[model samples]
Target chain A: MIAVIDYGAGNLRSAVRALQHVGAHLQVTDRAADLEAADAIVLPGVGATRDTMNALQRLELASALPRLIHAGVPFLGICVGMQVLAEQSEEWGLHPCLGIIPGTVRRFPSHVGKIPQIGWNQVMSCAATPLLAGIPDGSAFYFVHSFYVDTLDPLLVAGRTDYGIQFPALLHSGNVAATQFHPEKSGRWGLHLLRNWIRSVT
Target chain B: MLTRRIIPCLDVKAGRVVKGVTFADHIDAGDPVALAALYDREGADELVFYDITASSDERAIMVEVVEQTAAQVFIPLTVGGGIRTVADMYRMLRAGADKVSINTAAVLHPLLINEGAQRFGSQCVVVSIDARRVPRSHPTDPLRWTVFTHTGGAGRATELDAVAWAKQAVELGAGELVINSIDADGTRDGYDLPLLQAIASAVGVPVIASGGAGTLDHILAAVTVGQADAALAASIFHFGTYTIAQAKHFLAEHDVPVRLV
Candidate 1:
């Protein structure tokens, strides 16, 4: 079964709906055992870095996340969940994150047509990964964020999305993977990509 | 780079989109679901639905319309008019509205914006303003624009500043703001560019210019002078006078960075 970690984040229903539509076993919760028991783990998150990280700490999923990623378990992160893979974030002051991948999150400067690019945008692939398997090269996925991650190792970037500037949309390294766009909300193409994620592990 | 957005708005009353002259004189545009699907196919970046109903029965009907639209359209949908409380916001969003807009409701209780923003995050909260120019209030009269509600029927006297309110709303956690000029609403005279420019100067978020929009030149004027991120129109789009494709083309010709439909 696939375990979808729910740490009091946004749109759990949509994530669960996407998983069910694609015939994926998705048990949504903050429990430690579910994270350990599932064939693959998907961390679905939204909102600012400080608040999300705080919520994870309050739920005690902060420590569990790194352990799961380190154990070679196939992991998929969504939007803000994808950002936390970086070393630290500058939103609402500096704060540390999961740091599974070597990177840091920074706010997109104001000149980029408002702060949050809230809508569907096209993403270009940068690296090969199973999580992005079968997805189109310039597929338009739904995005709603003002912050982006700057990864040190560019080779791990599986996909790149451009708003005012090009930013890493999806990152893949060994068993760890993440997407800056909400595949669950991207309709059929999003569902197909998410299904491939579940299949990669199980 | 970010592209300027062309938005089509549908006023759904009793589970069906019925366009009205000003606020009354309602007429059936079409089935809400079918119209939404058509807009999506026509390449609209976002869709806005204004529920002009006053009571709970009509509000329930609006929810049904939202459900149908959400099921049919994949693009982002924003709903306004009658969203008074957090529960109301949740109902629309749960039914599949990408965002919920509060206008008269926020004017009555400005804290409602703060409360909703805290509960649902600012990303989902949008403040829709309906401002009318009352000459008696004078050019220097900060309250010249009377914020209207109940479809421009009722409004309370206020010495409050609209610009300050917009700034505070953003500070209170509103991700986006929509400035609708009641004076220009349905006038087809063009958008109140000065009003838009003022709001854009006051806030650091995206502002959508609504109300006036008669010709293609109006849209360009709004984008260039008004500095609005998006332009929303009802009659023009609902009546099929100007398609979204045409609007994008006009914007592109004006050297504006509008995402082509």
Candidate 2:
């Protein structure tokens, strides 16, 4: 069973609906035991990195997540969930994150189109990964974010997209993976990605 | 690159879609969920549901419709029309709405924008402004339009200028702005391009040009000439005048960037 880690930072209703539609047996929970017992884990979040980090800490999952990822637990992070995996974020002035990935999140420059790139944009696969299996190279995904992860390690990049500047849209290392866009909100291509990830672990 | 978004706005009264869609595949033309699913199949980037009903009983039905629609439809769904306070936004979000748009409420208490953004994150708060062009008596007035509170009904014009108000709304943490042209609402001549351009240029966030889309050319004009990030329409798509696929194909052919399924 897949465990969708929820800490009151974002909407898990759509995520649950999307995953169930893909025939994945998953439970949305904030418990540490559930995360440890699950076959695979999906961390879903939205809103500010500060709030998300705080919630994860309050639930006592902040320190536990890095150890789980290091132990090779199949994991997927969405939007702000992916941002919290980074070392730190500049949103509301330098908040520390979980450091599962060696990177810092930075706001997209104001000169680059709009502050929040809130629309469909094409993402191209940068590295081969099971999480992105069967997904096209340049498929459009729904994105609503002002900040993006700037990975220090280049090999972690799995998918990249362009708004004004090219930013990492997807990342993968070992069994851990993440996407900057909301695959739950993206149409069939998104569902396909979720199915691919579930297929990998199941 | 981020492409232009084409949104089909569904006006829902009670639990039914106000303008019946003509899609033969849908079970009921007035069913909002069925229409929304058909639009999703037609490759619509996002869907907006405007609850036109005002009564408390009807509002509950609207929430139920939102829950059912969000369960089936995966794309971003924005609910507008009756959202008044942070509590109203909370109800919509809990009901599975991705975003809540406020028009009169945002104008009445500007703090509602800040409060909603603070609670739900800035990505979910969209301040919709209904504005009409001012009949000019003085040539030197920089303001071309005044903000209208009650969907631009006569005697509803406020002291706020459309462009200035848009900039201020963004500053107060509105992630996006919907500029509705009152003069061109149902007439469908075209979008108020000058009004759209003025506000789109002033704001750093995405601006959706609402009201007055008669044809595919008008949609093209809204994005290209008016410089809007998205074009929203109601009657054209609902009456089967044009499909979202056809509009997107036209945009792609004209060199405007759009997501083609």
Candidate 3:
């Protein structure tokens, strides 16, 4: 079973439906027991940094996540979920995050390009990670964000995407991994990613 | 580098794509899903689905069409017409619409943009403004334009300046703005450049200029002279007269930087 944590930020149903489409049985809940019992847990979000933290806290899943993740449970984060894996964020102001990865989430630098980067962008796989099994080096994924995670080690990035500055679109460390772009919305490329994630644990 | 976009606006009503001449003379084009797939393959940077039938019965059709289109095309999809609240925006996003564009409902209650942006990201909220030439009382200056509601509006007040409205809406958190000129709608004469330039200059967000695109040169003029990030057309695209691929090819040769097929 794949547990998709729904803190009510936004777009949780899409994640759930995408997992189901890939033939993965999933439950959308923020409970610790359900998360621990599942083969994998997906932290999905779509909003500002502060809002995402507030939603996780309101559901009391902020502290429970570390416990499940540390237990070697396969974990995948999507979009804002990828942001929370960092040390902190500058979305509205500096806010503490999950700290599963050593980095900070900051807004993209000012440029002539659109702020949101709202479209299908190519993601180049940089490392050999199980999370990217069958995915090519230049697979287009759906992305929509003004902020991205900046990490201390480039090796943690499995996939890098270019907007204004080339940044990591997918990151993985041990049993934890996250994708700034929504794999659930990235068509065949996204489905391949989810299947790889499922194959990792099950 | 951010490339200028060429968009095909599909007014899907009851699951069918209906394009009009001047927001009238509606004709059935094709299924929304098929048109989206074609646009995706033909190099349309993005696709916009305006729910012309905002009626309750037609809303279901729009949602179904969106789900179908989402499965087929991976390009950005902007949905408009009938989006009134945050919940409505959420529903569309879940259905796989990339952006939710609100027109009359947004201008009527500008805070809707903020609320939608708060729940979702600003990137997901698109505020579309329908403007028309205010018909200068004096012949000296014919550049005055005012905002209107509904399709091309009907005796509504043209008091609001499009630039002012776009500025305020962006401040309230509209990620992108789509401006349509009533006088230029389906005319094929050309986009209202002065109006587009004013609105684009006033707002920092990417502004999409819509209306009066008959030729590929019209798109070039809108992107360069009008200073818009994108040019949107319906009739030329729906009628098979000007394919999106050809338009992008022409714009690329002319150095407009549109995303190519």
* TM-score against native, each model: 0.85, 0.97, 0.85
Candidate 2 to native Cα RMSD, angstroms: 1.5
Candidate 1 structure quality by residue, lDDT tens digits, B87-112:
99999888878789998788778888
- Number of the predicted model whose TM-score against the real structure is largest: 2
Which residue pairs does candidate 2 place in steric collision?
A: none
Q: Candidate 1: global Cα-lDDT?
A: 0.79
Candidate 1 scores an iRMS of: 3.0
- What TM-score is obtained by chain A of candidate 2? 0.97
Name the regions of candidate 3 deviating beyond 4 angstroms: A111-114, A128-140, A187-202, B20-29, B41-45, B67-75, B85-96, B134-142, B152-155, B245-261
Cα lDDT of all candidates, in order?
0.79, 0.90, 0.81
The most accurate candidate by DockQ is 2
Which runs of model 2 end up more than 4 angstroms from their true locations?
A: B138-143, B152-155
By DockQ: ranked, best first: 2, 1, 3
